[model samples]
Target: MRCFEHPSQKRLLRFISPIACLISFMVTDLVTAEEAWLTRSQQLLNTLQGQAKPAWLENNPHQLEARQQVLELFNTSKPLTDLKFGTEQSPMGKNGQPLKMLFISFSLGETTLKGIFEEASGRDDVLLVFRGPKPSQKLPALMGDLKRLLKGIDPVPNIVIDPTRFQRWSVASVPDIVVEQDRKSRLHVRGVSSLSWLDEQIKAGKQGDLGTLGDVGEIAEIDLLEEIKRRMAAIDWKQKQQQAIARFWAQQKFEDLPTAQADRDRSVDLTITAPRDLSAPNGQRIIRAGQTVNPLDKMPFGLCLMVFDATVPAQVELIQHHSCQDKKARVLYLASSMPRQDGWDSLKRLETTLQAPVYLLTPDVRIRFQLQHVPAIVEQVGKHLVVHERKVRASQGAPS
Candidate 1:
């Protein structure tokens, strides 16, 4: 009031006041465009609204894929699809794995394994390799086999359970010796467990398969490499694929909600304070930091989101009859829960039953809508979201 009493100061204040208001309004509009939850939700839904993932991704988890690819490494018939082989360098295998290895299996027995381990001791380049896990591909079996074989041997040999090496050298028998340099086999001796014999043969300028100098004993156990290949060939990947997909879906973190009980209605405020300056698509400054925004003023909602638990038949039927289904606005179906037994199958079935594409409800959409129950319709009414939680138990026999 005292400052307004001065005429010159009043004129200056009048000059700056309009500019400040203009800046504040611009900032508010910018934030509204940037931080509006509805705008973000619509964009997300539009991208994934009706899109179904490929069969491989839907049914395959990383853990199972990892195990399968490793198994594929042992199959010599294929070109080694897994990434266990080195592609370059003279002596260095890719990812710093050893190039020279003694291909021995648990069939070598305790005494022969002890001898090989002692011979390979203090040798960095010569790594003891197993064509496959002992007894079976299970980790516990492999660990038990190692414990049984290397009980008394001091300084456990540098060991690697890489079946790729056996495939790389086309090893048909255990206790095979191989030295690779520059992606080419330099020396390979089948039916020999002695790393010392390999070194002596190399010293004598022996290259290629040179183990036939004298009689070599036959492997006692079934060729584990061949057995691994046979087992791999016998796998029912198609059946396991469905199980893998189910596991993947079961591991997902969905914001599970209870069945809608009573008829109710609610509102969601679209107001958001800008975290920073936001720009429009045309590169114009819209909202600046700290400005409160409501995006409905500029961008109206033209899409209706119908959320329900797909596992509930009554709720699904209610959604089918919801008024929004006949609205001019684009309707998106989002399921809170679906059958985890065969997620892809259930998704397909839901889409078939509704004659429309269905998607899984995301946590962000749930939080933004402030959803507490399923079988709900979310749409914009005027400037804020209006969630219509309809009661269908009386006629529709919705789940309690």
Candidate 2:
């Protein structure tokens, strides 16, 4: 029995109650700390995985930063600063994290495979491991097959295509099962078996072969790792990169903005009425429907938005005269429009000249600030947003 709950400690219970409360508080704080650390760790891991996934998939020229992140995510990586993955690197976690792994190879004709997939569906502790993709089928085909198998199944089976696990646990055949818990291998059934049966055997202190799968359909003829390497080697990365850049330009939405005929300044009332009642955590009505809320009343306007047409040379010169200097305020440059033929060069030049990043003005931002003319500066003053439209003449500033 626990010492605090023991008959011998009954008399001392009163004395230790306060101490127990303190210990409970400590445990609560520790759990909170652990959760915070876990969140941080997950964020870092996701960043590492995210960078690698996109750059690798998009066929970009090279992702040095993504490679570096991958290196940081792993322990015992060589040359600390090197971005490229080394050939002769010793990885950390060679034994693998303790897990219930179900080994399977992708095939067009594995009938029992569908059943196994369904049985393992939505299970957190169990994972379906594939040796590699099917020889005749591409990666997309494997995904499609899985899609068909787990159709309408919520929280589908977790899967991975890594031969390293097969090598580690000596998983020679498909549909085999292994149970690992508490950082140790408990049971490994190298043959056809169900997760439930394998679990039962492991619990009952039983060990032996559960028979093997018959000569079913075509097993994955290709090694997934080798196929991946081959595909990467065959790709025309230069053409892929050119296509990416072309797509970027095609997606640009640079709208036309009429030049300002006359200089004028206007204030836009940012007050908005709530559509419904907004309540506090205690169910108290903080704001009723149709009540106005001025954001400026609660928070200071801290950003100076500068909007101009990048296509117009004179307007560009007009923006240069104004450094957008505001005390303790951030400056944001939004381009009204850019020539599609030379948008990249124009954006780069604007950024270089202003020593700041320039963003394309979206319809939402234009509508949000109620912008009607080019070469305008939007600033927050008091409870209102002031849009200062600078009139550009045919010579002094920019032409219409």
Candidate 3:
């Protein structure tokens, strides 16, 4: 080297010194950082392991006894303490007078019951009474029989079942009638009688003796002309109702959309569609083509869309209880169709209790999720919607 070093060797020596230094420094830094991370991780793991576990309740004889006691209490019958009888205000008759009471029994022959109901039919003032035990299980069958007897009546008579009232008035026979003057004065018939014979008796009692009898009026006869007019009015009212429903369905934009399924994660971009305003600002929307979207951007908040049939109440209740776990997601309840008035009323009560928003299932929503059966849950994951057909087990307290 003293004789004269080569220029290439000198250049190589200068470059190699810095490169080696850089390599050594990088290796040392990596080793130090890795050691520090390992130490911190070990400390965290030890801390977690040292923490005390939560105390959990274990099954015991005392718990079992308490549960059995609770079940026994629930199984006991609760007597009606504040029961009142005959407090219902009678509806007004066509003559603007309060209707009279006609008490009868199911034990009466079918022909006799039909005859009495036919006479009492179409009279708003005539309240029909059927004597029976408190209707706990046999109410539906009794109502079915009554409806069959009053088949063609324009306005079916208001029938009440009151075993207590029957006992109070000393009604001991199958076919009986009770004529009342105001709420105080009452006349009780204890044997089978025709409507005409009852009318005659009521007239005789009104005229002959206010001492023995009271100011009871005769039962009004059914006016055929008035009945025809009422039938026409009912038809007109039904037509109006149907038209209103038609108008409601026509205004819905997504009524005819075909149902589709989204059982997996995927993007659903609209290639030739226009943007529209959504109900919620944070809600998912149809992504338009040519719109730039960041793949790494965080997804919008998910929704728990529960589709259910109003008919399956137990299953719906189970779903409602279970779906509360997803606290971050909003719940939207949708019924399969417009149910009967009673079912709709029940849904309204449930909506109030749950404090959740509910809607009717439109074709658009049903088709979008391709929902076959309900109750079902629809939720969003990444860019796609996941439709889950939740099966309710009989063991889960859902009705089989």
Give all TM-scores, in the order shown.
0.58, 0.49, 0.28
Candidate 3, which segments miss by more than 4 Å at Cα?
1-299, 398-400
Query: Which 10 consecutive positions of candidate 2 have the poorest summed lDDT?
Result: 76-85
Please give the distance, in angstroms, between residue 211's alpha carbon in candidate 2 and its true position after superposition. Answer: 16
CA shift at 314, candidate 1, in angstroms?
7.8
For each candidate, C-alpha RMSD in Å? 13.3, 18.1, 28.2
- The CA lDDT at 36 in model 2 is 40
Which pairs, if any, clash in model 3? 99-125, 259-367, 260-367
Candidate 1 residues lying further than 4 Å off, grouped into runs, are 1-100, 105-109, 133-156, 190-200, 209-211, 221-265, 279-285, 307-328, 335-354, 360-364, 372-376, 389-400
Best by lDDT: 1
Better of 1 and 3 by TM-score: 1
Q: What does candidate 2's lDDT look like per residue over 48-82, in tens digits?
A: 33243324234354444334433332321121112
lDDT, residue 357, model 3: 41
TM-score of 2: 0.49
Local accuracy by lDDT, each model: 0.61, 0.59, 0.46
lDDT of 3 by residue, 1-400 (tens): 0112323224323433322233233223222332343343233334423343211111233334445533432321111111121123334533534346666665555686787767765555566665532224244455566667766654454566554445555554545566655543345654534656666767776422223222222222222223334444454333443343344335434222222222333233311222332222345443444444432132332346666665566556756665533567666666664344443345456667556545556553455456666666666655555666656565556322
Residue 105 C-alpha lDDT in model 3: 61
